[model samples]
Target: METLVKLFKNNIRQYGMIIALVVIMILFEMITGGLLLKPINITNLILQNSYILVLAIGMVLVIITGHIDLSVGSIAAFVGAVAAIMMVDLHWHPVVAVIASLVVGALIGAWQGFWVAYVKIPAFIVTLAGMLLFRGLTMIVLKGQSIAPFPNGFQKISSGFIPDFGSAGTNIVAVLAGILFTVIYIVNELRDRRAQKKYNFEVVSGGLFILKLVVIAAIINAFTFMLAIYAGLPNILILLLVLIIIYSFVMNKTVMGRHIYALGGNEKAADLSGVKTKKVTFWVFVNMGVLAAISGLIFAARLNAATPRAGTNFELDAIAASFIGGASATGGIGTVFGAIIGGLVMGVLNNGMSLIGLGVDWQQGIKGLVLLAAVAFDIYNKKKVTFLK
Candidate 1:
C-alpha cells in the first residue's frame, strides 16, 4: 500500500542512525570474531567513549550555531594541566583542584565567546588561534611532563561507579534506573503523539510507536545489565547519561532550543525576528568551553594523570561525530542523540581495531576513510530527501 511505503520512508529518516549502529555492531562483531559485543568489551566501549560523547554534546551545539570550535581538545588538555598544577604542585586538595579547573574552563569559554560575539570575528579563526594558545599553555603548565598520583577520590571521578545498595542477589540501583528509563520513554513518546495530534500534524502510527518503545526498553535494560557485570557502571557513565537526558530534554522541549534551530536554519531571518544573535553565539561558545573543560577532567581522571598532549586530536573526533550524526557542515541541521551516536561509531571503530591488534597507521587510514564516507552519505541523504519532498 502507498501508506505503508510512505510510512517506511518517513521512519527511515528518524531511525537511520539506530539502524546504522545495529548494522555496524553486527559487522564488527563478525570481524572481531564476536568479541566486539562481549559484556566486558561493551561496557568498556561506553567507558572509553564517554569523554568524546561529552564533548560532542557541546560540539553539536556549536555546529548548530553555524560555527566550529577547534580549541576543545587543547582546552581539555589545558584544563587538565591546570588541575594537575593545582593538586600536585600547589598541594591543593583534589576537590578544590577539580572546581578550579572547571571555573578556569568557563572563563576560557568566556574569552573565546567575547572574541567571536562582540569582536565580530569568524569562529574558525578565533578558535584556531585559541587551539594553538591553549596547547602552548598546557605545555608550559605541565612543563612537558606527565603528572600523576592524583588522590583516590579524584581518580574516582571517572573510574568509580555507584555502589549497589540493594538485596544481595539483586543490583537495586541498576534495576531502578532501567525502570525509570522505560517509563520516561513511554511518557515522552505519548506526549509527542498527543502534541502532533493537537497540531493536526501526521504522527507516527501506534504500531511504530510501540515498536520504538520496545526497542528503547531493550537497549536501555541491556546496557544496564552490562554495567551490573562491570564495576556496576562508571561515575563517568552516569555523568554522561545525565547530560544526555538533560540536553535531550532541552533540545526537544525548550524554547531556547527552538531558538538555536531557528538561528541555524536561517541566521538572517532569525535576527530579523528579534533573536539575540550575538548572545546566542557567545553562550554557545561559552558552553562549548565549559564542556571541553569537563571532558578534560574526565580524560585526566581516566588516565590518572595530566599531560600536555592529552586530548590531542579530540576535536577531530567530535566534529567527525557531529558530521556523521547528520549535522550539515554548513550548520542548521543536527541532533544531540545523533552526535552521541556519531561519537560511538568512531569510538567503536577505534576500540575494535585496537583490540584486534591493528597498527596506528591502519587505524588512522581506515578512520579517515570512514569519516569521508560518512560526510558523503550525509550530503547524499539530504539531497535525496530534498528531491523526494
Candidate 2:
C-alpha cells in the first residue's frame, strides 16, 4: 500500500490527467444521454481529431527542444494546395503527389530550420514568418479557390476502415486485435516490472500492480469493442497507433531523444557535453515540418478538398495540446502518449459540447479554461516538487 502510494505521488501529473480524462468522459456520457460514447460518435471523434493529434506528436518534440512552430498551419495549407494542384490540375498519381508533398514539406522545414538553428533567430519569429509566407503561397497556388474530388486512394487514407472478417454484426478482426493488444500490453508491463525489480527500483505491491493491469486491459478491450461494433477500426487509427509506438520508442530509448531533452533542459550544458545542439535543433524542425505536411494531407483527404482555409489555427491547437499533455513551457519534459491524451481531451471537449447543443462560443470558452487549468496544474506540481527537493 505504501509503495503504491509512493508511486502514485511520484507520477501525479501523468495519473491525474488520465483520471481527469475518464471523469470528463463519464460526465459527458451522462449529460449527452449516452451519446458521447456511442460507437459511431467515438469513431467520429477519432477521425475528426486525427490531424491535430498528428501535429501534437511533432509539437511535443519541438516543445521538448524549447521551441515552437507557428507556421505549421500555413505550411499544411500550402502543402495541401500543392498536393491538390498536382493531383487535380496536373493529373499526377496520388502516390506521386504524396511523395512530392512530403518533399516540399521537408524543404519548407529546412528553410525555417536554417533561420532558427543556423542563423540564431528564435523559433517563434521564424515560424511566424513561415506562417505568413506559406499561407500566402497557398492562396497563390490555389488561386483563392477550392479543389475537390481527390482520388479514391487518397481519400481512403483518411476515411477507410479495416475490412471486417466477421459475420453481419461485430467486427471479428477488431475484437481479436483488441485481445492481442491487451496481451502485449500486459506482457510489456510485466517485463518492465521484472527489470525494475532486478535493478532494485521501487515498484508497487503485487496486488496494486495486478489491479492496474486489469483496469488498463479492461479499458483497451472496451474501446476496441466499441470500434468492433461500429465501422471497425479506421485506417487513420492504425496510422496513429504506429506513430505512437515508433515515436514513443524513439523518445524513450534513443540517444538522440536524450540529447533533445538535454538541449531543452540546458542548451549550453548540452553543447559542452558534446551534443550536436545545432544539428538536433535543425532536424527537430524538419521533423515537425514533415508531420505538418502529413496533417495537411490527412485534413485535405477528410474534407475531400484543398482550400485556402484548410489549416487555420492548427498551430495553436498543436501547441495547446503539447502544453496540456504536460510538456514543460521551459522544455525537457513530456511524452508522446501524453500529447495524444491532451489531443483527445480537446477532441472530447469539442465533441461533447457539440452534442449538448452548445454554441461554438461556449466551446471555445470551455476549452480555454481547460488549457489554462492544465498548465496551472503543471506549474503547481513543479513548484511542489521543487519545494520538496
Question: Which residue runs of candidate 1 sit more than 4 Å off their true CA positions?
Answer: 1-14, 166-170, 385-389
Top model number, TM-score: 2
Q: What is the lDDT of residue 254 in candidate 2?
A: 99
lDDT over C-alpha atoms for residue 98 of model 1: 83
lDDT tens per residue, model 1, 307-339: 878999999999988887778787788889999
Stretches > 4 Å off in candidate 2:
none
Measured with C-alpha atoms, the lDDT of residue 86 in candidate 2 is: 94
Q: What is the C-alpha lDDT of each candidate?
A: 0.85, 0.92
Kindly provide the TM-score of model 1 when superposed on the true structure, using C-alpha atoms: 0.94
